[model samples]
Target: MENPTFSIQDIPPTLLCYAVAELDFSTLSPNLTNSTLQSLKSCGANQLAGLLSSFTTITSETLVSLGSLAVGLSPSVLENINGSILKENLQSLSTINNWSATQASIIVSKCKVQSDKQINADTLKQLGSLVIGVQSAEIKTLKSDDILSLANNSILTGYMEKAPIVLKKQFVQGIIQATSKTKKTIFQVVPAELASEIPVSNLLDSNLNVSEINQMKWTSSQVLPITNQAQCKSYFTRVGQANIDLLPQGSPKRNTLLSNAKSCLNINSNIITKDNLVILGSLVCDLTDKEIISSDSYVLDALKICSSFTDSQKVAIVTKLKAQYGAPSKWTLSNMKQIGSLSSALDSEIMKTINKSVMIKFFPGLLSVLRVQHKTTFTSVITQLKNSSRIAARDSLTCEEKLTTDSITKQMDLIVARYSAAQLNICTSNETLLNNLNILGSLAFDDDQLKVFKGILDMRLPGGVPNEYLIQLGNIARVYSEKEIRSWNITSVDTLATLIQSASWQSNDSKINEMVYRYLQLNSPNATFDGTLLTVLAPYICSLNQTLIQNITSGALRNSSQSLEVSTCNQNIKNILFDKMKLGYSSVNSTSNAYFQIMSPVIGGARFSDLINFGKGFPEMDLSTFTTLNPNEVKTLSVENIKDLLGSNVLDINTISSSSVLQVWVASKTQMEVNSLGVNATAGIKSPVPNGVTSGVGVPHCTLYLLLVCIMASLLYMDNDFL
Candidate 1:
């Protein structure tokens, strides 16, 4: 056994087994190579059993020498290993994340036996990921002091991340008890990972010092557990202004916090004062319709920007303003400026009443927040204003001054914004407007408008639309007929990328696919699609036929940077992409946290069984993807998963209901559990979708359309109505 030239490969299996049995454990341990371990594993189970039997006592060194071969060891053999040996070697042992539950449990049991059945910080740290194998009852037995001692350590946090809901609750209860007595609050003592586990009851502690709470950093997940009227009141009162200011505008946390705060505060608008409104700040957005109507105009004026007001709330404020000022027609420029962003709430009728001077002054702020329907009306108002001014100026100015390039450009913008397909005759007759037809890209044309606009564009670019003109067309390119798009000479991937990325095709699948197909056939006819090209074409990749999608290389899919956009693709496309993704990101355990991190964007396409395989990484799924999950599949998610998921949005009811999967999942939980999950049992549910918007396959299509138009308008005509 001590031969200097000896190699495991040189020895016969039978002889090597006997030699391994006879060798000193310490001497052989250090010399064991991965090759030597594989050779040992290949020796057949019976032979290895004979070899293991020869050792009277197995030490940590002996197990370390086994390396991956430990995975091959039977439970009976593992159980026979001494607890002291297991305890000392737990750190090394736990590195193998693929261990079977039975195998890991045996290690935990042996470690506990050595430490008097109580898991302390040192032992817990040593267990590493094997803590996932620790049963719910064992987790319940975790002492408060032990958890507190490891407050700064990641061991408990790591365990809570992957542990089942039932186990996490038990562990969280221990944490609640552990932090209750300390001068520091739970926010001060608990690791951020375990922050979501704290219940609303614990969070609503009346004894909490506001100054102390304000000083601590709060994550959206940490605040998500406060859902009900009682919790919102207690939580908001405790959180202080500093922490509240930390929430981002239009975020789910801020929305839900204000919603619940308004309900709980139950402010009386009839008697509310200016100072009270100032103190309420963003919470004023939550004031009921009746309350808004009753509130004094001067007091309402004290409030500034309302980042996200519901359509009904906006109407109520407008109604109150009209009552105070008579009608918008009678209101002066001073009145329009006084209302600030409330100007966005004004209806078409009210807008028509507004004179040219007041609207020009107010348009900047109003344009940013105008509702979709109001945009068309506002465009007509601009047209009327422009026409009246032109008539007055025409009598005083010569044709040379009236038809100047700047004046014609301004007129082109007005016509594009105001004219319908029938009214487009004026533009067709004007050579100057036809030359600046790229301005048409600022608006989304219907089929009739597209026909008229296309005729004008064809007349302007009779040589056939080249790459430069196509790029300038912006979203207008999306409306081109398939024959017109296919006729374009696409010479560079950059040109294709720019047009595809810039243009947002609403439901024009055929047109988008035509553009994509033409680009592939012309620019990349023989080339294998790389990450750069794949990402560039991501917007319309779903339109690719099955064969083309399946042909996309695994390496390209792994390296592609358009995962967020790709996640929005149809199920068939995603399924194909995910197949290639799996090949690129192969894992021994597909459910591990590492796998989830690499595969999260496309993982939504995974089968229900594969999705349920997720361990600690379950919460990493994005909200949009999380919503598409089967309700029954969501029901099977671990409690810790649900908490972490809900906690991501800070337990906002509106946020939760936005995902029907979460709504159904929340409905199945007990009232007590629901409160613990972060929403109140009594809070009313509201649609997450805004007014005059529709979603397709969990995506907010109308919202996206408006966003694209705004972007295009900003790039083309900075002062267009779409803005």
Candidate 2:
């Protein structure tokens, strides 16, 4: 009666999704509720309602509880599956996920017998009994005989339709026999329906020791906006009109102070257009939200810019962006997304030649390009950029390729060189003078980047609670604290960490992020630094490979939290962790587990990995790599459903040995090299004899462990802080 192959074609995907959703209900209630049964009864007892009523065995409430085996679940989605006979039919599907030959045969035999019998009262009662027996057996169904052991536990309980029951010897013994592991009886078996509801999330914020409501309580009228949790997504947006400032009327000095404040805040002139909206953005300080009736795009962008800002400087740029780009949504994808395609989404609109330090800090990349390319002249590869507006005036040549046009480089004649930024009459609000600075300082930075950065730190943050006491945090920054950033290469690991941690955007809590970002920024390869710095940074380069050093540390640490944060804070970190771990990591047992646990409620990500791949390194988590999904696939796979599947797989992957017989497909990514053997290299010995086992168990091999320490030392030669 058993079939070798099985398909879930017995039910429609929609119906299946609905069944799972319904079982995942608010409470357990077997009795048919009037809300649904009424609709079915309207169709009469012997009709669709009658047939559906018979399916009471598989209510959505029951099925969604076995969440993993099924997909998405909704309330009342299983009105038809509330009956005893139907519930068994639903449980049978779990066989597909956890299928084995014997279980499959048992299922097939049951189905075959049911099909051969008549569909009357006696048959229905028999089927109900069988379904109850299946529930009792489910307790012992998991691998490692763990479920078997759980089933045998006195604490275990089961159900027959609406009633709960204890397992009998017949079903309990059969499951124990089928289970494979003796000592490995792992997790107690959760009935299939219960697993569906506790969908694990990939991104977890372990930092929060409490709930959101409790966290938000601190940000009330009593606390400063800095202490208040700023919405990380749109901290700069002026939610309503009051948050935005119009010109304040006062005496000349009052006007001057307000003007200076506006300039600092980046408030632009009041030019309310039909399409564009000019508002302040990127400040971490709080603002009250008011209604904006505009349905246009530019205004929305201005709103976004204002909202995106948190720092005082960001407020100024937001003012300028609104003054300049608040025209209309001439292009699609919104101004923010469009501009992001070219530069970062946050463009403070404030520029500074007078403040070269700020310019370099703000636009390091553009500064880097300018440093190498400025006086050195590059011809316009795409000669039309200078005449872009003219050509656009004639005809807007908006194409995918045109939109993505990169910086046009080519040979050019002697260009007028000046460190002064372009005076782009941007976001000045009723000011006495012109603010003429934009990115020119970044160009001149190669000559004075670090000096300017150091000056800025000395000015803004000042010697304080953390950094002033360098021995504590300065130590964290140097050495192989996390990834590739070694000790010698860094000038001030504490300074860098302080910068990122102290970022206004992360004003809601104690600053750990400030430390993270500063480390990454200075670590940029383009910026020239003393050779000793690199020697210290990639210390493994001296003799031991960096990857090997990381490997030794990770193995000793075991996928601990220390390995997690440093492993992902920078691309360099990922490179080292992945490479060292990948050297010979059995595909079946590979783990992407690790994270840096910070001690704050608010933390801006210095490492790129935190946001996109938050909980991935926390044990067993695998994320969706789908660039796009077709409508058909989307229909079958809702976000909730996909999330469920992903959550289960992520948690389970760790348990499943990475060294499985099956081939794993870890993405090909950059990694630090561990050991390289050239084809031409000679092996000193022709053959080496292997000892069958450790000749002596208790014997201490000081030499072997010493070699391991040596290897680790070689890899982290620059790990002064770690040492």
Candidate 3:
């Protein structure tokens, strides 16, 4: 039978099935011909099953070669196939439309085993029609994250559409259990199609915590199932304003919920107290205009609890306030503060009537909420008040007392500082007044304000923005566009360093890259960049292209004083930088703890062989660098090393478990070690640590260690003070 070279097509038709089954299937040179496979389909099931069992391993090619004869394979043979091989060929195997329930079940079991008992959306999608064969018990075992993935995936939803009701019920229940573990509610997790299948009793269950029901949209049809009026009122009331605000405005769902809650509370706007308004929350907008106007002014103030108010509500409140306060000219500062957001609805004439001091005090709050048209009028009114006030105060000065130049200058500085960014009349203000305006650094000027400020700065410093002015500008320096900053004459290293630090906070990547390029272009020599310059600009050095980065001299990197900030740099950039650092810092032994410590930031770029060479020094590497290592490389680390590396990150176990790639490395550990990693043991690992026993080591004591260190440091400081 060894090396049987005879073609199966040469076999007589009557003997073909017997010849195919009897042949040494493993020793057969080329695969069976398609005509041979077609003839084999007429063979008995036991004969075909025997032929399939001859191979030590089943591959996708073997299955494809079998064609329709694959259906004749015994369940036991399919069950024994390697899960990894099965997962690899699931799409091709799934193309077989006539699989029996038993065959499909075996495939699903193998798939689950391959995925470590957690099937994600892609696997579910590949299963396709075969998903119907999944058992309710198996569906219940799916991870919450996996369930959430399936719920979010539209492709999986199509698969679930044809699945059995029992499986769907189990899937929905899994969603409920999953959502309970996190801040998300059932409404947030379940899709529209599956939502209708959720039982009414489940919706009423108190396990769905009220506080967790913060934000999610629900259609009227979806919510209409919960017909318990009393329960709805209590749940909605406790859920607070956050949930109500998230509801789609003007949707039937919002209208239905409002109508139902209003009826249940027996809300009467005419007799409504401030307490009623507080309890009603966002439902206050549902009240009629006449009802709002009829409500007491004190009761109306409770509307502030709601973040947004309807236009009709604002109008009604304004009318009521005007009636209570009489004329706008007679309205006091107390009246304005009492109205709160109602001031946004006030006319320009009404704003002009307010005292200058009162107006300035109210402008900050009003500025944020004002309509576009009202902002212009308010800005104009404030400007006029500022000019008239300065004139009135100067004119009132006694004739005998002459104003000094210093006094006049000081007076102007005081007046400019008193106004807000919106009220600042930059066009009329002199250079001295603009320089004295220290208030510009504190306020976040809008695009228009920044444009005006830039114009003023340009006129004052016509040569270009100097380093001193950049320091003076503080956060406002960020307002300069990337184009303008790139065009600057930057020569000083200190200015470049300061600009890099400032740009890191608010500037986008493109802008930071431009700033670094501009500074380098101006300062660095045409032939060779300085080592000290590289060290100062280390954070942004990675922004350069690969060729440019490779061109940097090894001597420059070796002589650099500070560590390169590679956290924001991609793997390619880190690889180039790490290579340069390796060559330049040749004096440092690669296997020493010093090497790992110094190279920890860019160690992720190191090759697997290089990491293995680090040996004991590997433990000293940063945890973030460890997370990026290949799973196989991670597997080579000792259990004690893993415990040491992950001990401090026990709190991040959930985040780690969320990633399939990280989970593979985590699953490589012993059950006891995984439990010690501080997550639920039943999910994949072993028995949990006893309540009194600390899980892993480091993380729990990190704070106390810091505290002890601080105390010792303090004692050392005290001894030095005595010396």
Candidate 4:
């Protein structure tokens, strides 16, 4: 399937024609060789035309040679030649001057000028001579003058008789300078059978004035015919809004125009008007509830005066006004005052649309309205506000409504006076109960309300109690007795801790704390104090039994005590351990069994020996569990404290010697003390190595002498002189 290749120098004339025929002219080289010229010069007019198909540029030399070969133009060759090349070389082609109308039409039709450049006068005249079968598309590029010139030869008249309606419109409209007399002649020449097929748009005829257009015989039958609805819409759009009123009322154009104006309601308010709305209401007998509500305010105002709208239409309009201007959550005291100006039925209908949740939220403002207006029916409205879906009356409280807390309490008091404990309990959600527990207790609930509250707590516990609910529940613990607190099986240690914290918010802090402490001891006797619980109990330790505080705090650290040891805790309790428990060491004495209480603060943070002093014991512990002490603590120890502990034999030497960290401490303490005493360690003092200790990890020799001399001297001078 490969095409045969031929070079320009060796290609024979017949073979060149074959190659030219096989290839697209656009793909061929523009360059020409002497052999190509000779080959083309000897070829017939048909072959010369075929070679020209492949040449991108036609030199005068090439054109002159090709023109000499034109004994006659083959119709087939002219058909294959490009139209642009033919037009450019038309003057040289003398045979076309003698051609018949059919031959000239064939040649001109093949000339391919792809641009929008119009044909000049010469081409028009040449084509005009052969106008018998001329096409509209072929001559579409002719100028207005050239087209008018065709009329002079009667060629345009002939073409219009056969051309389609679209071409006829384009051709006639393109001649902006053509006279009405010429247009009338063109129209007169159009086939009578196709006269009615011309649209009204074509007759808006720049050729005629307004008066002439009106006087035309076909103005109604041809231009404004009452046909289908679509054509009527088009006819009306052409007539425009200013002239639409001139049309007959019963006509299809008028009816369609009115229907479209009525149905097209814009969301924008600025574009709509009262007059337009009146016209719209005339066409649409009934508007939907949403449509009436969503329309502009001007439309609503117009509907009110129109008297054609029904009562439902008025209700829908008021509903939208309430939703926008008086929405329950967003409405303020000012809007509540405006309600007094409204009619009784409209005011009641507006209030009825508000659901229970929203009614509760806006209750304070509405209550203020009722009080100011002296409306006794407000009581019934309040009753209607209490629906099953509303969680609690307090939840509807909008604090931003500028109502005082006292005002809220007064309103709540009036509402709760009529309801029994059972009715209030049914509507209250647990969250509402917890959030307003303090207010609930202050409400002075009768015996039945107290019983209902106890039942709710029981119900809340059977499912696992969320921490927030437990904290709030503990706030109202003063309402119940010790027996009741003990009856509730308080499980999670964390919840027990939260109960102790919540007592501070109640009426009697000490009484509630004691009750909760006793309840914790009785129900969950095995509960241990982690950091959180230990912190909650620390402040009350001075008031409660000392043994209980001791059991909670020291029991975790003492090996003999069986309480659980707390190693990790939240940051709040950890901070409390360091700041509060550490400061509590002022109460420590040799007689107490609270040894771990003294050490608990140091174990939580910082070094053990950093907080350590002379009196506190160097408590024995497993060496493997004690690795977190800071290495720098060894250098900061006082010489007097080191000797006091060493002479007292309080720490086991064997256990200290076994630890690498402790060995460093012992060597560092001895070396530092010797330097502080003003002794030269190279000659005066000897290093001591304990049994079971490594020798190589001793203190460095380069440690400066006279360390802490000023500190030691100041302390000794004060003790001797003042004490």
Candidate 5:
């Protein structure tokens, strides 16, 4: 029941062939002895064919070798051969010299051929004997060589001549290598449905007549992948301008042909004229920016000569030019002139490509030209110039040239006062102050600007301080108190000196005096008296009290002898006190009650010795130097001074109420008592009379309490006339 096994090498060729043909091939080993394979030639062709048919998995090479051997057997073997084996060995079909036309027809009908592989020429010649044997579709599937071979064979030509349109297109594509005469014949036979589908490159190989080239209408889908520059040149030459123009837009062939056209033709050639280029304009548009820019000079010249462009086409050209050159700095003068010549619209658009510096430098001249040439749009041009100029100015300021005096002034001139404090702060600088002097005079500064201005002033300039700059600093000082100024590092001494030197202190006395006070306060820790400075500051010393004066002079003179130039210092001191006393008394009528109230405590503390010392410095006056002995001065207490003392105490009501001085005054008031005994001038006396006491007795004593109250009240009112 089991199949018998034999060593494949031991089997005889005739016996193996017989067994292979009779048994299920699935049961047989594919391995065969070389002797057995060589002896296959002795087997009958019918048996060999049957053996090939029995094996489903035989290699095509094995089938082919066996089929070749089968040729030595019966011719009838070819007729009964498996179609798969026949198709695999179709190339071998031509080698079968004894094959009949009927056998050829049978093989062609039975086999399923590969579509991609070219059929042998000998096979086509053999198949041509009976064209009806081949499927119409199969005929079209033939490669170029097979189709050309069939084209030459008169027998098969009849069937191919009237093939269906799809088959006709394939047939036309296949015979690309056919002889000119044969290709011409084939072209002449091409059906109308295939007219557009045929590659124009194919027709050129056949020396297609000019009329034929013109007549061929390429569809939009036509693809000609040829890269032969000469062939492309020749095709375009034969087709002429009109027919070449008819090529599909953006088609590969159109690009290939035009690129070749430029290289082939000279600029002066008739084919390269403006009219021809105008016809080929669409092809120019299809070229990439790189391609057009890199194209041959003749091509570019041809484009230049062609002037029949629409506005949109010019725009497209300019757009491409922009892409090619990128920024305007990449363009040369010649490039600018050439691009400018394209159209006024493009010339105007090119302005966008220029660097801001270039525009600002050259715009005025260009604007003049534009005003004449593009008069209607001059205003818009001006507006654009202004906008670009503003950016250029800002960027220039941000560069190394930013803080130059001229640059700062130039930028300031353009500002419309609309910028925020931070934006305006960009312009605050020592250079700005030194150059513009009054830039910050009216400008409102926020906290940050104030800080920046302070820094700007703190920097030492070329000169000590500009004469006119003091006015500007006065505005700043008015806003910044001494504390704020110190925080910003703007030394109050320098500011005060600058203000004094410029005479700005005359109009801004209160601010200047405050600066002096602040400067004095700042130096208090290490203060020393400077006799020379004190002499110059004498008249202006009215604002400061003796205590502050003493502190400042003490510090200024700390290193110097206290007796240095006593004579001159004495005169200066005398003048200072006179000025103080004179101004204080003269200004009291107009001075605020609050001013007097503020000074009231200082006046109340003065003593007779102090009055003598002050009065000695102002001996020219009629003022009296009074102490506890001057009952006359006590009688001179004015209602105004007493009221101001009360008001001054009222402002600090809590401290005054709890003060020891008020306790003493109140205690003295409660202790005072008075007793009186009186007799009429008629000399009547009481019933009980004292010995030395007459009819009437009255008591009034110079008590310490009374004297104390009187002295305290007068002290509160000071030598009230002596401010």
Candidate 6:
């Protein structure tokens, strides 16, 4: 039925009579509010009585929430309210056999205006009885004069005892709820005529097992009908916002979310009973700071939901699933061969984007996963769940009853297989890179991990990160032609230099700049990192590492020292530096490659570069006109040219019987320093001064940058050789 329409003049007769009778004193109950009695007493008993006699009625629903001030008044105040000459509805009070003195007074003051004045007086004399008849049985009725005083005294006692205060609370809450409901309905129609008609109890009856409802009647508690979609959405949004705010940052909610995302690769359908929305929601909530909103993480999760779950589970989950892709079952390694592109438009979540790099490294493991694991797919499960929800709209399940591990792993496997190697490596290693590798990426790589990343570039999972891990790592290295290492998280010079050195050593001449670019990108050569830090990077460009690689490749780097005792041809370079120029460089005459030795002699670190880069393109040299090539005029040459021009042979003066460029012998001085050119490296130590630049130029301006620029035009010479 529709609502009954009414105007002011159309008020119901019952409502009118009830309203007028309310003004009469008959409406007063035996239990008067002391607060009300006190308030009206202040207005005098005659006026208060008259107001009560003419009291009107209202709808029971509206009136159910009303209360009075009787509990707040003293006995004297109640007496004053009764004695004041304003009441008229007490005429029928004479028949009372038993009543409280308070009830008698209430009746008389209410009926005093009766046409039969005699009956009115008589009733006032005996007033009592008939008070909701079933409850109040033993009280004696009181007479006219005594009734007023007794009622007033009772009212005072109520105020003192705080008995009537309880009654007022119910009245106010009822009024507030009714008024709000009425207002809400005034603008919007409530389809159900009454509370009993709501389907809430039907939807949540015993089988739902939703115990422990919050008893408060806040607006949120209202069982809003589904008919109002806007209200329903508003309610859910409010709930979601509250949940996010309540969870603090960095808590479990924030931590390890990345790892959880990775686990999606191995998730199986055995546990896909839970809603797919949980994964979607977590992706949204946890990806707080990662800049990419529609990131790789989001897409992967959405795919997992759409593809991995079992048919039954799928029907129950994936709420608000805008994507219509069908679920798949029995994922096999062969399925891996099907998807050409790794990215699918599933859900665009943030964690997926920021950590896409780390996820790339796990392909081998994931490939291994595909070869041996599991039966059901996430698609079957999610599909089953969605179907269930569609059939049972209001039915919801508990979280644990929702998802378990066996189920979650099936979902993750699809993600692992679908992701690209570069992207996955980064995402997979996010934890390691962000916290460990990234921080020390610039630190000195004396540590074993850095060494592993540089050389091992690709290896077993437990080993250090590889170049391919950071998306930008290989790009900056400029070593596109070389086989890529996997640790891109190496932001530190030590790690980057290690990567640089490893790539440079194994790298072809063309690929050197690529390696250099990557190293510079990580180390930021122009960015002013620490000097000690820069020292670590120096070796990546030029290193004693070559001696070992040459051995590894030719069965030479691993040889014993005796095995390396220079042959007639090998010693020319070795003996030249050893006997002629006498410049100390770390030396090992081919001992077992594992057992290495270093030179303790006072040779500056930079001299090693001249020795290493001599012929292998450390900046090739092929100068044409030494006389015509002025220092002011520069010409560019390949790293190979510079090396050909600067080899030990060029520095090897046959008459002098020396193949080394120049000597750096030790002085008796205890300090380690530079000695201009020929003296001990320790001959030029300076005292500490405010903001000083060390006057050390071990590297030639032509070694990397200048060398490439001028290799074709200038002769390779030491500072002393220039003299």
Predicted structure 5, TM vs. truth: 0.19
Worst 10 residues of 1 by lDDT: 395-404
* Per-residue error (Å), model 1, residue 110: 30
Q: What lDDT score belongs to each candidate, Candidate 1 first?
A: 0.58, 0.28, 0.58, 0.44, 0.42, 0.29
- The best-first sequence of candidates by TM-score reads 1, 3, 2, 4, 5, 6
Per-residue C-alpha lDDT of model 6 across residues 1-723, encoded as one tens digit per residue: 023363223444334332321222324442332222333444433223223322222222211222231222211222234332213212233332333333333333334433334432133223333221111111122233332332234322232122122222222222223434343321122111122222244323322211212221213324343214323333333333333434344455334432243233232322321232243343333332221222332433433322132222322222212232223222233332332112122122311332322333323343333224322322322233233332432323222121123322333333322322232233334333333333223322222334333332334334544445443232223322344432344554444444554332322232443444444466554422222222333223222233322222211111111122221222223333233112211231211111111211101221333333333422212221111121111123222333353333223212221212211112212232222212233332244632322334453233454445444444444444678
**Which candidate should be chosen as best, given TM-score against the real structure?**
1
Superior candidate under TM-score, 1 versus 2: 1
Q: What tens-digit string does per-residue lDDT give for candidate 5 at 487-595?
A: 3322333344444443322332444455565556666643323432343343444444445554443322211111121112233343343334334334232232222
Segments in model 6 whose C-alpha atoms lie over 4 Å from true places:
1-236, 241-723
What's the C-alpha lDDT at position 37 in model 4? Answer: 54
Clashes of 3: 0
TM-score of each: 0.55, 0.21, 0.37, 0.20, 0.19, 0.15
Candidate 1: tens digits of C-alpha lDDT, residues 520-630: 778664444655567666556766667677778876665454553454466777677777778776632465443554566666566555665664434345455567655
Off by over 4 Å in 1: 1-207, 215-271, 298-304, 307-315, 323-326, 330-334, 368-417, 428-439, 443-450, 564-570, 587-589, 615-624, 630-723
Give the clashing residue pairs of candidate 1, or none.
224-650, 224-651
RMSD of 3: 34.1
Clash pairs detected, candidate 5 = 527-555, 528-555, 528-556, 528-557, 529-555, 529-556, 529-557
Candidate 6 has its poorest 10 consecutive residues by lDDT at 593-602
In candidate 5, position 240 carries an lDDT of 39
lDDT of 6: 0.29
Where in model 2 is the C-alpha error above 4 Å?
1-447, 451-551, 554-560, 563-620, 624-723
Whole-model lDDT for model 5 versus the true structure? 0.42
User: Is 4 or 6 the stronger prediction by TM-score?
Assistant: 4
